[model samples]
Target: MSTELTRNFSIIAHIDHGKTTLSDRLLEFTSTISDRQKQDQLLDAMDLEREKGITIKSHPVAMKYKAKDGKTYNLNLLDTPGHVDFSYEVARSLAACEGAILMIDAAQGVEAQTMANLHLALDQNLLIIPVLNKIDLPAADVDKCKQQLEDILAIPAEDAIPASAKNGIGIEDILEAVVARVPAPVENPDKLLRATVFDSIYDAFRGVVSYVRVFSGSIRKGQRIKLFATGKTYEVKECGVFTPKMTKRDELVAGDVGYFIANMKTADEAKIGDTVTDSTHPCPEALPGYKEIQPMVFSGIYPVDSSDYEALKMAMGKLQINDAAFTFSSESSTALGFGFRCGFLGLLHMEIIQERLRREFNMDVISTYPSVIYQVTKTNGEEEIVDNPTMLPEQQVIQEIREPMVRIFIMIPGDYIGDIMALVMEKRGEVTHTETIDDMRIMLTAELPLAEILIDFNDRMKSMTRGYGSMDYEHCGYRPAKMVKMDIMIASEPVEAFSTIVHRDKAEGYGRALAIRLKDVIPQQLFVVAIQACIGGKIIASERISAMRKNVTAKCYGGDISRKRKLLEKQKKGKEKMKAFGKVNIPQDAFIKVLKSGD
Candidate 1:
């Protein structure tokens, strides 16, 4: 088939808006997957995605659709993730296509992420087809959704196709619109060998299997290809397209979306967003590569058993090859021993990575509380970025500490404005602006410290709005604040893992909460255990775990009262000596329990 007959596009949407379901319906309608092979989220190959009902990685498949125009066109459909943490996946998918299907839930109307994704698509200048999904449900208001599209997105209401991905309604209409509205890939006249690598995965047998879109040339078996980024060359062991499964093919020409096995042992050799060109006939210039993605949330990941440290390292290396947004470095903790300081795009991304390590590699790992990056300026005219609380300098050495800030757009029903305002204020966030999205809905723009919203802010917003709130945010640089490093001490000894950077105003409250939580989780010792939260020399909050007293007077019931008193006196003397010299053994389970609990 010629390049003009190929249509490469992606389905982009918010979480749980039926993006995967629509992909399934399209695959079924096109007869791409057989009856026996049919399943929900067919493109979602990961076990995590199936259990969570969300797309984590971008899935690409090729379909030969016979349209009403009496022509069979090749459709390359990339099913992308909807969650905000995985937005990078959607961006990578969008780079491989010329068009996008913007999916929205009819009952929920437009959302914060919906607009975020739309701007991403627009940035790439891709043709977008607005879609109103789940139209068959009783609560689905198609008219309201279309109006939201028109007013907010600026897309004409009539352009959006209304259908239920669950019931397979209007599948043909969507395909027809994609065929008519989406432009085909234009090939370079010189026909130089060039391709864009959208994603890559590691396989024990196949080496690195890269998912690529042929832009101006072709790739075939035994062809020598070079990665522009690394300047490394590899022999293409195999080249094939996905029918939801890799199928052998003779050659992949221009405008083709498929995988190529290049016998490259590691993912570093073939990086995501790298340009691929033939070794023999390279293109004059490489395609403009994607912008680098930086992680916003940081945490420490350590194995429950110290012996599994090396195994955990190997698992992290393998996992990092598949995830570009995850980062890790070797670090030692006084409390957890040796571990890796890991960085993630958000809390969900960190959680998913931990879950994958446990399930896929069978490594028992524990993660500390999540934190955001901080900018610290020292008294000697030096500046540094610190992701961990342990890396923060002393109060006298640090001239000022600046926290990462984000501009957030929250969409919610009109009734919850006051609640949202209070929640934002509590998090040390300021509402910059507000706009009425519709009669029943409003959008609030706020600037907040990234660390304040890392854990339960989203959950709280949803609860306050009766499940009608959504938020999307972007980094707005750093701002100077009165920040201090609060440490949690057990028996007057500092535990590095439990330390955090907090605002001066809320230091007492946060410290009290953490100290109380620690007291509940930490086991009692023979000596009294003092769980204290301290800011340098001063302790902001403290909790005491009373000593476990032994019954020394039980055997002297028939003896004189003075004799019983003598026994008690000796017991008290022993307790005092123990408190002076005994070491408090803090259980490993205590750290795990406290770290796992949310704020």
Candidate 2:
């Protein structure tokens, strides 16, 4: 085993609790970034994360922090995803770190998600360094937060350094604590070289760049290393350490973290939790890795033009390089023709990826309602997966279907507890446990079917809690819950392209909301639209829009029949492109709107 000389720790915090900001200060302290032009959340370089004010992905950075005792040590830091949807990613990243810096908001103390992460860290047996962040704020109550942390986390409260990461207060103290309390990384050099890949990103020129922490022995460039999970060997072309903005140093040793570039190009081959070992002297056994993440939330995405299908595929492919949770396959429909079926970690993840695809890839897409995958077993004992609600097998063919269940945790003030409980009960959620956080706050744990959360759960939770609640969930298991297939009908006829399987309790609300949203975004055409929600053969509710009763006059204004005829022809061509649903001709924009609203 390696001596504890350099510690590997990750910064785990709730959304917007200054995890990235503190990370930036750490980088500045290490001279990775210029002191004159320091930016907030340097690691959150993605435009979407910045706009959302959340960390959607985990980023790893290496820095050299000099302790107050005059000892220089290497620090490999991982900035983990703060959202509940990316909980699986956080777990994988946690496995790579020996310790974690738990950052708690001073005013908020410990949130539902903070407990969830702390529990995960405990499960992984990682040493934890607790810090109370934003303590300089007027609302900051460092003493109370430290007490709460000590009681809940069972970690020492006296060492809970209070920091205002924004102003750089207590940063040196935080570093000193990390160096003093957090043990260093493993330093077993004589053992077989073993490393755990925690994250990866694709570089167009470099192929798949894998981020790994050497746990056992040494590795150098050009060494043949076998990926234990897949038994594939690759000669390392390059190895180095990383900062938020740069990659420095080479030939990383055990207890140190670094990146390696392989000539291998595929992303799947470099899975997040896969183990890498010396091919010649392979470890007798491979490190235990996680199961392949199956996406529970799915949606259809189509290009505005048929010619852009290839571009859309490439864009999704590029995104999947870093995000292993993103699942996609080319699909076709009679109504929308050819498109892509995208699978996500959850609804939020699905929405973020879709938004990123549109905004970053510059691809206008027509998306379908997000649905969960159901189990289907054929008569001949064939197992099948049904992700698209429209493509589900006939009722008779599906012997049994199940909905995914999630273990949910919520923290809210006492005043709003009634509202939150009522909301949960309405969504078919069952309370499993509850704990009092303080006089007015409680932590509620429940097991909820994932289908119930696909809708406006976040918005509804915030509204019910008066913006004083936080919720996070992890997939528990699939349960045979009371579920139904809700068909989206257009003009009394079920549109196979617009179907979803929702919990019976939520079908009507979602159906009505979908109709309303579609009504708003569908453009006016020569014919009216009939948006109806159906369950099996019964139409629960329906809405109608009258046809385009008025359009530009056919009269030639200034002998520009070319423009007028072109306009009319364009209208006719657009009308012709729509799939006929009785008297309704739904526009592409309506499809996009309905899908976005589903999130």
Candidate 3:
């Protein structure tokens, strides 16, 4: 019989490197999901994640594996988020396990993000099992990839497991490596229950569902546990594991990953990195972890149709239930009608959430450009949250206006390095270091302001490099930088909702492009509309829409006064159905044209 030892580990890979598909095969092998029902990527339970082909959050699952030694071991698998925007979730997931199965796409070799993740995993001191995935492809270069992995990550190359996660080859070897190298959890039979809250999501009925890693002791249903950080205690109403699927376990002991329900509702109660302890004898302190995340990108999300304001608010609330990173507050606007201001982890996260809101919730939204939070010191030496572009204080009156900056890493073909460098320069990015990864690929390190890449930066990068360049960035604190105000003018007056803080160097290009784009989208209306870019009180540029002179005509009474009134009634109804921008009402395509032109 195989030994009764257990292993708790997680599979972490860059986006789309077969992590989910491999997890599915493991689930099928253990019969968690039947072959007939196994579509693919079983642990990607979220409909949005599965449909988007990117894991926005990490999910924990449990499975029983039968080894060749004829022994059964419980495997707790955590599938982590792959996007850079979700790296905080990834770190929490890694901390939950004693080992990590790092899957590298054999054909593509190691990527910039793959290296970043590897460094984070090393810092955790988890046993690393390097697996070369997608070996079934003809272009797979196992030997070369092995050499690079060893050279780059300083790990053993010969030990790298080559397997097709799609076809289940070498999966047994992967399990064997885990059982051999990964240490089993140390059980504390006498100690009170303690678990780490790796991540949490909100459920309508359950409040917050905390996914925890049981560290030292056993926990049972109906037991009272205290969340150390928040000093909140609640009775466990439910407990279960991802047997590839969620399987209810009456009691989960040390060395297992599971979900528990604490009627201690509210998403803020069970914060990630907090510890779970017995309520009767609480732990002295919470677990040591990274500091709480601070939002670096700010944007305004407005409802396109004012009539759907209530629906948009409800939809945003529902979306935030699962996405704790989203910080929002409702505000009213004459221009936007009504909407909420949103803070995001970064630009990508902002875009992803916006797209999700539109596609899944069917809510049409107008998003302002992503701007970084400005550190404004008042005359009394106090601080405030200033996100609006027009709200900036005068340079002389300001004590200091600090901007957030980050360390950016990019991997691109050598031939496209110059073009990428030029783009970065235009964004006020400064190169810190450059290294050659291979004859074809080069790695660039730069310190860039977060606001620089908030707009069509991603699209522009892809277009310039022909999709051969990719980048990842982490906030590196703040710096003193030149700042300019971007004003969105409606008619001839500046709209407070449209102002943003941008680096002085980039203001002209971005402002001009936006003005041009708005000109096309703002539509011809009953009155003329003008789009202007301003720095402080001065308008730098403007784009105007000619006045619409003939959209309506008056009708006289046709013998009967009521008959003429009926004709006017029809015209009023038609005008009422059109979209209103400022004082002008426009047709449907007007708004659509601005979005499509992307000027």
Q: Which candidate is the best by lDDT?
A: 1
Each model's lDDT: 0.91, 0.79, 0.76
Sort order, TM-score high to low: 1, 2, 3
* Candidates by lDDT, descending order: 1, 2, 3
With candidate 1 superimposed using the best TM-score fit, by how many Å does residue 178's alpha carbon deviate from the native?
Answer: 1.2
**Consecutive 10-residue window with the lowest summed lDDT within model 1:** 262-271
How high a TM-score does candidate 3 get?
0.87
Candidate 1 lDDT score relative to the true structure: 0.91
Report the number of the highest-TM-score candidate: 1
Clashing pairs in 3: 2-70, 2-71, 62-242, 389-499, 389-500
Candidate 1 C-alpha lDDT tens digits along 1-599: 99989999999988999999999999999999999999988888889999999899998999999988899999999999988889899999999999999999999999999999999999999999998999999999998898899899999999999889999998888999999999999999999988999898888778778999999989999999898999988899999999989998989999999999987876578688999999998998998888897999999999999999999998887787788888899998878999999999998899899999999999999998889999999999999999999999999999999999999999999999999999999999999999999999999999999998899899899899998899999999999999999998888789988999989999999899889988898878877888889999999898999999888888875957999899989988998898888877778998898888843
Candidate 2, residue 77: lDDT? 86
